[model samples]
Target: MNSKDLKILNLFKFDENLLISYSINLLKIIIILILIKIIISIGSSVIQRFFNKQKQSKFGFNEKKADTLSELLKSILRYVMYFIGIMWILEVLGLSIKTVIAVTSVAGVAVGLGAQNFIKDVISGFFILFEDQFAVGDYVEIDGLSGFVETVGLRVTKLRDFSGDLHIIPNGSIVRVTNKSRGNMRALVDITISYEEDIDKAINIIKDVNEKMKKEFKEIIEGPNVLGVTNFSDYGATIRVVAKTEAMKQWGVEMELRKRIKHALDENHIALPIPKRIIMNYKKGETNGN
Candidate 1:
């Protein structure tokens, strides 16, 4: 062989042992990844079992508390496992774990300096869970956005509104929250009648309908009784009917009250007020005439 050809062959020389070593490392990595998956799956099931046991025990943990804790624990477990997996993969690639930690510590400080809001969000999220501010399936109004809470994560909270829109809100931004699912809600239905109608008769009719509704809808907790004349408008005098209903049932009860009252009033021939307008016409040289 020529000298140049020999040099080229030397440069291209293959190390079979080195290749074998690398193949083995690759296989080990694959095995590690598979094991991580299996371990995580098993760990998740174990965590669920633990919580389920807690729920059934005399510990007095409600379903909401159990569910919330389960989600948070699962999330923390997944993150820890992924972090360990990443470190192991780095080691397989012949990287120094101590050196990686030192570098990451420095980088983490730098990131922490710039990510104050992220830290705040995480802290607020923890407080939200601990304080029982609200839970999944609760209807709440936060910063004027009202919806059912879907998930409360470490960094964000998700809400699904009535129209099926999902809103993702940062935890730190939820300053004021109005929880509507905590107690009974008020259902108010105002019935207006003409000035000429017998006010007592209308009130009695509404009371009758209210009595019937109380039997029909078990959600009604308190009276749908007439509050007497609540308002006098140009169109009519308003007789307000107020009822206290179970949380989330108020709207439905209010709608049903309106329908029944309307039917009752129509059957009794109680005239609902109609709008009236007075028009005036004036000639150029004369005063106004109606």
Candidate 2:
């Protein structure tokens, strides 16, 4: 071998001490990884138990709120533990913690300037949770998208619509939220009766149906009484019935009310409106034709 090649070979020679040092560091890294996983699992379980306890307490913390807090806490904990584990691993691999932090600080300044939206999303998410604007399982409309909230994470919120489509929305973009599941909702139904039928008789029939429904459906909170003749169209006169129902139960109640109203009208011999048309016939020698 030439002199230059011999010198380069000597520089990279694998000595016993160097091999031992690398194997020790590798073993330490494996141990650190295993420990991180174990700790994270245990921490997650603890967080869940804490929330479950809160849910079972009589202090007025509902299941939905408890679930939301649990998920958020677990997420935060997992990320923190992973970050710590990575920093420790780097230190074990001969990089000092202070040096690593100094380098990251310089990079973080540049990243922070470019990631304003990310910061805004995280801040907005914190406010959403703290303010109790909406929780998981709540039917809400945000930025014109209506759905049941599935998750409220630091960066994004998940919504599942009636059609089973999942929407992932960034938290910063959710400036306004309309929550429909917060209180009672109104269930409205309109029925049309023929003008020829007695309006008084139709009203009585609807009242009877409403009385029976009030007893059957406990979700109905207020009257399903007919509001008299609301409008007159070419087809018929419209009668409106409205009821207050528990949140998320309005649609079911409205459907049931319509079905029962139809049956009641049929039983009482009240005729429902049907469209009709009149036709005029012209002879061959009509005035305009002639």
Candidate 3:
């Protein structure tokens, strides 16, 4: 062997203690990682069991509240475990945690600046849950995105609109929320008739239809009674029909009410005005001569 090659081999052989130390450190890290997995598994199981028991208890929270609490617990436990595991791993590698902390502090500032939106998203999501602004099954309009909430998460809110579009919205972006899932909703339809037709007779026909509708639909919370003479024009007077219905059923009730009213009016010979226009013309050559 050349002199340089022999020297290199001797140097490595002389540093056997360092090599062994590194090997030991790596082995410890692996063991720590395995223990972390075990700990996390046990923690997760315990959390689930505790919540499950609470769910079964008569005095405990309801299903929705229980589920939300369980999810929060799981998230916190995961972060705690991961943080401790990383710290232990660094310690086993003979690294200075104090120095690492300082470095992380600087890194954290940079990350925080870059990830403000993510922080806002998490904060907003927590407020939403805590305030009970909306739930997973709620029909809501958030920042103009109208849909049924499919999932509420720490960073994002998922919604599935009526058109079958799935929207993944950052909770931070939702400033104004309109929840349509709660309480009763209003359904109004304007029915127009010929100006020549008797308003009272048309109103009577609508009232009869409303009476039949009330009996048919248990969802109608209030009258589908006609509001007289909502508007007037050369075409006709617009007769307004209004009802209060259970949430999400407003559209359905409105549609059915419209159909029924139309049928009733047609059957009763109620006239609907049609827009008419008159055209008058003079011969161009004759007019010029005049």
Q: Output the number of the lDDT-best candidate.
A: 2
Candidate 1: tens digits of C-alpha lDDT, residues 125-216: 99999899998778999999999988787788888999999999999999999999888999999989999999999999999999999998
lDDT of each: 0.88, 0.89, 0.85
- Ranked by lDDT, the better of candidates 1 and 3 is 1
| Candidate 1 overall lDDT versus native | 0.88
Cα deviation at 222, candidate 1, in Å, is 1.4
Model 3: residues with Cα > 4 Å off, grouped in runs = 1-100, 284-290
Q: Which ten residues in a row have the lowest lDDT in candidate 2?
A: 281-290
Residue 221 C-alpha lDDT in model 3: 97
Q: How close is candidate 3 to the true structure, as a TM-score?
A: 0.69
